[model samples]
Target: MTMEPIGTWHGVTTDELGCVTHLELQDNRLAGEIPPELGSLSSLVRLELTQNWLSGGIPAELGNLKNLFSLSLSINQLTGPIPAKLGGLSRLFTLYLGFNQLTGEIPPELGNLTNLNGLFLAHNDLTGHIPGSIGNLEGLEFLALQGNMLGGEVPPELGRLADLRHLSLANNRLTGRIPSTIGNLEKLLDLELEHNMLGGEIPPELGNLANLRSFSTRGNDFVGCIPAGLRTAALNDLAELGLSYCT
Candidate 1:
């Protein structure tokens, strides 16, 4: 568990020897809820249970793992809201909990993980506004929260995450304008916001993004010119922009 394990999911049969540090149980027939006893493994570092039939909300005991780094529980039948205590894992780097039946707004406690690099919470029935506390994740590079019923404005606090390279908020019921503060994301490479109810000028401030390579507004009600800085930059010069009209 101290040693980092590699390789993709191979189902429940993956070796669980005490000395065997890494294990992946993705895309398998392993049914039933995640075992609470599994949290007793003090050495486990990465646990991926994606693309399975595993049901039930994540066990609160998972917060007991101090050494855990990567935890992916995406594409499953799990229900109920995310465990708020998950924010206690200061060492966590990547957390994926997409494509589930989980409801409720994202826990603000997640902002406590300053070391997190990737965070995914898409395709669920989640409601309420995105938490502004997420702006505290300075190390966050990838953020995905598409295909949900999430509403409310994108938090301007998120603009503080200079390390963010990818941002996706597509297919939600979100309203309000894209924040001008988004101009702060100088390293962002991709920004996706399709099928939402976003309006107001596409903040020209977004043009400040020097690395922006992809931007889309397929079904939103955005009105205004593309940011001049982005339009003139070489990054957008070769980029394929996506836009559509829905009257």
Candidate 2:
């Protein structure tokens, strides 16, 4: 018996009905803005156009892809605000729009993606408070909003993401104390809050994250000693802990 590879071969994938289901063109040196006509592919389930020179705003028409579950447009020259319409893709689980020139506050409408598992909007021009509505994504495992201009207190609602494995809010203008509720993320492996304006004492409750491999709160305004529990126990064994900047 011969073994076969899983999923489509590459250029495109179609279903039994010949409807496009997956498309990938990463690092193809592709240029120009994404064609709004792409939203016409009603049956499309996955789309990738990463690491290209694509520019202009994300098409509002993409919200029409009811079947789409993954969309990656990272590392492009994309500018303007992310379409609030994207929140309408009810089936979406992974959405990557990082490393672009995207501007404006993250649409509160994105909280509609209750099925999301990974949400990456880092390295953009995003500003304003992190939406509390993001807490609705109970299935989310990865959330990255670093390297932006976002400012405000870390919403306590983020603590509701019980499934989060990686959480990064580094290199932003965020301020305020660390919410102790984050200690609830028992599955967390990497937690980065460095290079922000956040200030306060380290929360001892973070010691609950025994599964962490990398944790950092450096380059912030935090004062006092690292929690006694954090200096020893399982956390001390992490591959990287950036508390050296704590005062």
**Which is the leading candidate under TM-score?**
2
- lDDT per residue as tens, model 1, 92-198: 99999998999988999999999999999988989999999999999999999998899999999999999999999999988999999989999998888888998
Model 2 lDDT-worst window of ten = 237-246
Across residues 1-247, which tens digit of lDDT does each residue of candidate 2 receive? Answer: 3343323555578888777888888998989989999999998999999999999999999999999999999999999998999999989999999999999999989999999999999999999999999998999999999999999999999999999999999999999999998888999888888899988777877768778777776677776556544543334423243444223
Provide the TM-score for each candidate, comma-separated.
0.85, 0.89
Q: What's the lDDT of the predicted structure labeled candidate 1?
A: 0.82
Instruction: Return model 1's CA RMSD, one decimal.
Output: 5.8
Where model 1 places Cα greater than 4 Å from the true spot, the runs are: 1-21, 232-247
C-alpha lDDT of residue 124 in model 2: 96
Per-residue lDDT value at 38 in model 2? 91
